[model samples]
Target: MIRIKRIYEQLGDDDGYRILIDRLWPRGVSKENAHVDLWLKEIAPSTELRKWFGHDPEKWKEFGERYRKELSEEEEKEDLRRIKDLEKEHENVTLLYAGKDEVHTHALVLLEMINKKSS
Candidate 1:
């Protein structure tokens, strides 16, 4: 199963094979405290797309579309495949993100894609 959680949240026992998916390290979170099994910054949205979205609810739909397009490009295929591989290796793969807006974050879009592909 795939799960998404804010990196700032307390680590959970079931957060198996945690992967940090943010382009930048989360503010104030040290490497030791992150409990991340892998850091896939390459799978994150491009800096240009991130800055353009700016966590605005109004831009959420377009942001998801743009980010999905970015993830579909040739350069990102390897990282996308890695995520799928990890899901098969681990029972519960938790994707960590630093965004404050839980509902509108890129993790949600990524999760949708991963699950859709698996189905």
Candidate 2:
């Protein structure tokens, strides 16, 4: 199973194989506290796309499309494979992100992509 979670939330046992999916390290979060099993920065939306979206809800749809396009590249394909491998190895795989708006973040889009591919 795939799940989305905010990195700032308290770590829980059910959040198996936590993977940090943001391109940049979240400010003020210590590496030791993150409890992340993997840091797949390569799968994150490109810096340019991230800047363009600017976490604006109005741009969410476009951002998801643009980010999904980015994820279609060869390198991102490998990253998705890695995520799939983790999902197979663990009962639950949580894609962790730092954004405050969980519903509109790239993690949500990525989760949808993963589910689509798995199905």
Model 1 ranges off by over 4 Å: none
TM-score of each: 0.95, 0.96
Highest lDDT, which number?
1
Candidate 2 stretches greater than 4 Å from native: none
TM-score of 2: 0.96
Angstrom error at residue 85, model 1? 1.1
Worst 10 residues of 1 by lDDT: 73-82
For candidate 1, lDDT tens digit of each residue in 12-86?
Answer: 999999999999999999999899999999899999999999999999999999998998887677777788899
